[model samples]
Target chain A: MDNHELFIQGSRVPDRGPDGDLMTLNMGPQHPSTHGVLRLELLTDGEEVASIRPHIGYLHRCFEKHCEKLTPPQIVPYTDRMDYLASMNNNLGFAVACERMLGLQVPEKVEYLRVVVAELNRIASHLVAIGTCGLDLGALTPYFFCFRDREMILDFFEEICGARLLYNYIWVGGLSHDFPEGMDDKILRFCDYFEARIDNELNPLLSFNKIFIGRNAGIGVVSAEQAWAFGLSGPSLRGSGVAFDLRRDDPYSIYDRFQWKVCVGEGLVGQLGDSWDRYWVKVLEMKESLSIIRQALAARPKDGDVREAVPGRVKLPVGELYCRTETPRGELGYYIVSGGGNLPERVKVRAPAFSNLCIIDEISRGALISDVVAILGSLDIVLGEIDR
Target chain B: MEFAELLGHIRAALPGAVLEEHPEAFSPWILVARAQLPALALLLRDDPALDFAQLMCLSGTHLPASASESDRLASIFHLFSPRHRHKLGVKVVLDSADPACPSVAGVWPTADWHEREAYDLLGIVYEGHPDLRRILCPDDWEGHPLRKDYVTPATYNGMPLD
Candidate 1:
């Protein structure tokens, strides 16, 4: 062999081997279930798994650095891309972080409006989670059903905000623009239609079906103790018997005025907290979210400023703060550090999918390969959040 | 709990680290010395009175404009205790010279990935992390991009960072 070939071989770089004991498989940089550009290296023992190492950062667009470069208003649009499925929630999160630091109090009307829009975003996000979960488990019918409902919600979002998927509608102090004319009536009608259809059509077809139950129930079992240790939050944690919902337990954005149940599983068809338990938690969460929307709509505020009367230039003080909210996936937290400037010095997002995805290595080790798909599907990971 | 109460609790636990309380906000924050971070975190995790067991979020932030080295490079850990339904925020400062802190992966295995992301993007090395390597950036990528003074290179795979 040539000297160059000898030198390259001397370096212990990993390569595909025909008879290797540990075969490495790339899950996705584009695979459907990854939710985004996440690629996981799965080391398996023929068919059974030995180790699952996540290789992330394919979509790391240096958002935190970019946030430092732009004015606060300019940065609002970028938050849309972070957790794209729940962009409104991401928008609210970034706005609240800045608002809290600045000690700005939003109007009551704005609060109620925020709750309505945020709840709609939450339901829309959960639909994607549930519909996509169904898709991963070899069911195609539910995707169309859930998306059909999702499209209706998106139509409402479009009427209120110009954009549908990545709506940067919620701005600092208040919404980018107040709900357009007749936005309230449209949202109310959508909520009523959603609430009725959930029980009649969506629940029976997706959550209550015998086939879905058999596929998800008793699979990807993560005990309550394990869930807490691994920092599982939102529906995944609630499903594991922890009645902690940030909207209820830790009220933010006028959530204290609303009443809702933190859904936990009694394991109707399985043990304490399996994939089915988590799956059902999302279903119940959507119902609770609809209730929240209804209440917020009823208590609409008459007159107040939606936008805060702050300096035209927005800047955070030279301090650090961590603000979190319950997203459809779990707890979505944003940690921001400012050096008393127009742009934040540092911004770190504690995405729920990252923590939720981490537990896969611990739980999926012993489950069958087919069951791994179910476990991952039930975990409801959005790779955009995971990779970011 | 109130901000003063959280400050008092943290003060009682870690006598070495400096504490700052912001009464304006609903929650209080504590700034611990970089050297005493792991011990302080251990105390918060182990002490029943301040059992901040759930590491809700561990993140890194750059403060390049801050005058003091104590504030320039910071890694914050937000802990939540479901048992008590209380939250605590902890911060540690790292200097630009060597941005390394003890790995909390031992305390929470999930920190394994979070710390790597911090190391990869912010250049804050979490020492003793079992699998400490570039997570979000390619192994050959130069310079941490999250630093305040970072200049985005021309292109990554022909797409400009801008």
Candidate 2:
């Protein structure tokens, strides 16, 4: 069937009984699409969902309490565990928080290198988000194509650092180690190959496909006003036609030097703020991140120091600070209250998943059960970030 | 918004409570009486000029005074304004004798889980939260560990609370 004809069809909602009533169902604390230990109690009137209550905290690791006992430098590694899909971006946030707290200035070369690695990590994260989003929509082939390029990024990560998934590469003052031998070429090659791969395989396989587009085009919709009310950041907010990217609005690093497009939701080409718009926004964002990565690499400085003198252990000032950054999902904010000692007085993480997931109870009020999974997938929630 | 002006706006809305404003950071911190939190939250949310509609985060912390056996706990509310691109922080001090405060779930539904989290971890009860069950920790878990004077327990439900 054509894409438009396919879009005209609705999800498979089971018919009610003689009295004409539906049943409620719990999807997870173990389902795939809720994405890691999330239990969504779905109230359904047949296969059509009446409401959804997301029960999180199955993976609550007490990360905030752990931050209380550790020093500023000690907390950088913990950010990795929150959203493991994009570890470098998490590391950058911790480093920026510590930098702002202590007023530490990194060198120009360090800034350029941080930008390159962070943008690369952004691309890697978007690949996973888009790939899995497509997988949730039943396009299984794109996962292989997306992960194939993602493996190249992981190879570059392993080359520079020792780990694949959780690279604690970005330290408090600067990077853990400078770029290894011929590291720049591998990254450049990955970027050059990424665009053509997305165009040929990933994009057409999902965004342009009839079934894929129909499943997601108008399934789950969130308006710009609702997006702001829910405190969404990153691509989830951008997917709702809001132009509020922290990278551009609140430039923490060398984002000012690079020029890239902020891909906002264009209504899924057929429906605005639908699941398809949310999914396609990330795919387009990956392309934009590649442009940023290219610019950051082109203006690279070779002979500058990547390390600075950060105190091994120091007490923070006796006060509180709330710092936020744009992560792969949305706004990941850290609210730390320091007691002017080795440990934080209290550390609270305003995770993106927690905020983004709040809107689910509103948006999924009348969606189909299958579309609820599609909508949850489109939100791109990580349970670690949600339950932290 | 200027830190003093923001505090002044909040103070004007709720006249009975004392307001504390600090200028060290761009975001100002407001100190309101524990009893006035719900009203203050409503005022902040309903006021058109300072329509801080979004509750970004709600967290509880330990007050660092050396007084033993005293209830020295503090709760902070972080509010965000998307229209103005600004943020304001509201905090209240609760004592051990009666560590209770009003809930903001009535104003913003997003505060429901956050308030329950605070109640679970810090033992600061939100008087008006509908379903105030343990959010992150076990339902039968005892003692708020996030408090400064919390005693470390060896075991809970036959497993180490570690």
Best by TM-score: 2
Each candidate's DockQ: 0.58, 0.54
Which parts of model 2 have CA positions greater than 4 angstroms off?
A1-14, B25-27, B67-69, B160-162
Candidate 1 chain B, run of 10 with poorest lDDT: B19-28
Clashing pairs in 1: none
lDDT of 2 by residue, B37-154 (tens): 7788878888887888778788887675665655477788888887776688888988866788788887877788888888888888888888888888767778776776678788
The residue-level lDDT of candidate 1 at A128 comes to 89
Tell me the docking grade of candidate 2: medium
In terms of docking quality, model 1 is: medium
Fraction of real interface contacts that model 2 preserves = 0.42
TM-score per prediction, in order, is 0.90, 0.94
Model 1: residues with Cα > 4 Å off, grouped in runs: A1-22, A302-305, A308-311, B1-27, B65-72, B155-162
Tens-digit lDDT track for model 1 on A359-388? 888887745556677788888877677766
